[model samples]
Target: MTTIEELLPDDLLETLRGRAAGYDEDNRFFTEDLEDLKAARYLTMLVPEEFGGHGLTLRQASQAQRRLAQAAPATALGINMHHVIMGMAYTLWRRGDHRLDWVFEDAVKGEIFAFGISEAGNDAVLFDSVSTATPSGDGGYTISGTKIFTSLSPVWTRLVVHARHEDQLVFGFLDRDADGIEIINDWDTLGMRASQSCTTKLHEVVMRPERVGTHTPLGPNPDPLVWGIFGAFELLLAAVYTGIGERAVNLAVEIVGKRRSHVKNAPYAHDPDIRWQIASAGILMDGVVLQLEKLTGDVDLVGTGEEPQYGGKWFLHFSGVKGRATEAAKEAVELAVRTTGGSQYFRRSELQRLYRDVVAGLYHPSDNESLHASYAKALLGPVRE
Candidate 1:
């Protein structure tokens, strides 16, 4: 029998590698590529073996996310909106529907899932979301509210809704086709242009009590102090940041190395100021990779449901990885621009799109302001990670 891993050849993903860096210009759309990924069974890397999946480890999952990011941040962002959850949903669903044998198998076959967290009011962590779930007449609950920037909404069959039900935090799984739910095509984002992070709405949708399954086990729901916490998830973001930085630097170097040297009374790539920026970006990318490996290794060790020593520091580590990687990635892209000269900014060039898209990672959740507060909380020493 062919394994799920065997089904998703690196070549297929690699074929798309340049696309991530080339996204907006290429007119790429998940609705267009997603079927092919599903046909190849590329999304099942995380489903547990019992669920008939390749069940790749956290390291493997992180590496896959990086590869996809390298191809197209939007592709990775949309696909990984499901990819990150693939492996773990097995564990999560195991606690609920054992029949996920079919779903898990299908996921490896490229079915996807996405998070419905960012809404009209809650684009970032600090903002409050408008979505809510309330106790319906029966054991089940009704979910209603609008969410914006909900990526992969078009392709995903399920959405993991993080909601507040009567002042209590809970999550729920909602079907895209449910009677009361509607997905609106209105992301209109400046960067990550093809990600399709649109608006979604649910109007008093109902779910069977059992389907509630421990809280919206729809996508990547982090269960505090439990299996939901891991650097694999956070570091995946780091890997994307690193991948963007790496490509931006490489493309810049390629452009600079070929430029006229000493033709304009200047060394071009050899100029000290330009050289300094390239060198800085190189070091910054290296730092991203190092931090990624360290956090991945650490998280894999204690991903168990049990409490561990690193637990207290995990949140701080998240802040640092998210904070630093965002800065480093953006800096590298900026350097790529400085080194490539004005021609690189031509509206049609790949560099332009790469520069624009890479910037989106910087503003993703855990922006610098939130990262600082997270670090501050960590330093206080009395609270948890």
Candidate 2:
């Protein structure tokens, strides 16, 4: 069967670009744009075959994300949270009751599945999620705690919250309207404004055991190759940042061609210094993209199941790629700003949003300091410099 990536027609790509182009003017894209992704079945790429999904490999899925980001970074970010959350469902596929054909079919049919894993008072790492679930008379349990930065939560129908039970870290699907849950005010962030990564409160919510996945612990993901919990998150954020850089470079190329340099008596594109800076950024993204592509291939080959550190080298690859990509995208966009000057920063300008979006990646989970420490730990075998 043809994969969902193959099904993404050229028209959809162009429409995404148009939507992204609009973001600079007025951050118009929001959770609703995720509906576009659902309609396109972009969110169902990882559902297993028995669930009637395309079951794409990671590399193919990464390329799909790359293409979507290339069109509109804002829309890409919004839709992708749902996409990634659904994709991660594959990791939980083997643990739960696979017979719940609706979760699979509805997901493939474009249902928006948002993941909630980060908690405000917790360790801030994947394994550090401190939300808890306790036994109830029913086969399910009572889940209570506050989850923060639930990307795409503002509009999702169902949210998957991860919490620790006695021995197993469980995954529970909570309806947005479910009792005991409240979406606090909107997320006011320096970047990714359209992502809707808001804080959510869950007061003693009831959940069924059938709706939760068992054995996935509350702390560090048991996987070795992907750093278990943090790898996928880092990889996606890096790819997104890198994609924004790609857009900036392309914009710079288009702008320089038509605009004349006020000082040099020629187009700025002809200036040696500007040309070199642009080329340098382009080259860095080129290298980053190659690494991202390779990493995707590695992930596909490695699969999602837990293994060992040496067996998978998970922490090492994710940290390096994520750190490199975020930095590369940020530096490139900054340089593009230099290449374009004051004109690109205006409200009417395209580069304005590109610049904001690209820099946002810098603070994501794989930022320089956090990533460096992770890699250092991998090398020195503990959390060390």
Candidate 3:
């Protein structure tokens, strides 16, 4: 029964909020925020209690991530990469797939995990990889390719990556200190600047037999590992953006209550148009909240030995939730910006930073086009050849 309040107290959140602007301005990693979260053991929230973690369910973890995002989206997103890997491992283990048991054990020992799946020009996503996984004579693989958007680059001890091994997609873990691995310090971005998601080049980096995890076919398939990854990644990503929307709505209410409309001789909160904008944002957020809750709750049930009957609809649920939440967040932030008046246009304003951060959601997996296509295919079969 670990509460989000206890894990991220008001004082800690305030400290993170206060530092957010500075980190954005300097484009540096949230080192202090990471230290604070580590002290609270936030990184191990998905690990079981026996492994020295909080043993939180996916629903609880999503709620905690939403709370954290309210204070600092970049920090929440940076730590989110670690949580995604842990969540996948936890989900698989809960379903009696102990292939990733070492993930939980290593996390308890304080080894941070990072994602290294995204690549340049790899539109096939998890189904295919631009990187190569050449089999070694010793039953391992030598990976060589560039991985973009490698979050937690500054602190991760282990990196989970994927590459193509002929007709199969190979997934494995690599130690940060492994030879032939190079981290490029080029992560300058429009928003989520504090994540430091730099580019990592693997020059035939060796992954021992024990390090390799799962290998699947070249295209989409119903592998449990794939299910675990999609479920954890989409849900957690939605949680973070939904948090941004929540923060935006709160800021709008606070700002409207304080600012007065001279023409109306009253606070902006009393103005019908301003009130309508805030209310509209709230209405949209209400649906987003419900969607997140329902989806996360369903995933949690799977941990208790409940069989998921989603079938192909699981992808629809996963991508649909993320797509809706992110787009709604952008609209909510826009409403907040419009309601807050000219001051929010300043670079120093929190609303301005949120405006920048929210856009990054558009580029994440299951982009709008892909999401819509998935939904269409689900509803009315795939496009005929």
What's model 1's lDDT at 364? 66
Best lDDT among the predictions, by candidate number: 3
By TM-score, the better pick of 1 and 2 is 2
What would the per-residue lDDT of candidate 1 be over residues 244-284, giving only the tens digit for each residue? 78878888888888886656765578777788999999999
Taking the tens digit of each residue's C-alpha lDDT, what string does model 2 give over 28-60? 435445666667666777666667777776567
The TM-score of predicted model 3 comes to 0.98
172 in model 3: Cα distance from truth in Å? 1.2
From the highest lDDT down, the ranking of the candidates is: 3, 2, 1
Better of 1 and 2 by lDDT: 2
CA displacement after TM-score superposition, residue 336 of candidate 2 (Å): 0.9
Candidate 2 global lDDT: 0.69
Model 2 residue 285 lDDT score: 89
Error of 2 at 115 (Å): 1.7
lDDT of the structure predicted as candidate 3: 0.92
Give each model's clash number: 9, 4, 0
Which scores higher on TM-score, 1 or 3? 3
Error of 3 at 355 (Å): 0.2
What's the CA RMSD for each of the models? 4.5, 3.6, 1.1
Clashing pairs in 3: none
Per-residue error for 210 in candidate 2, Å, reads 1.0
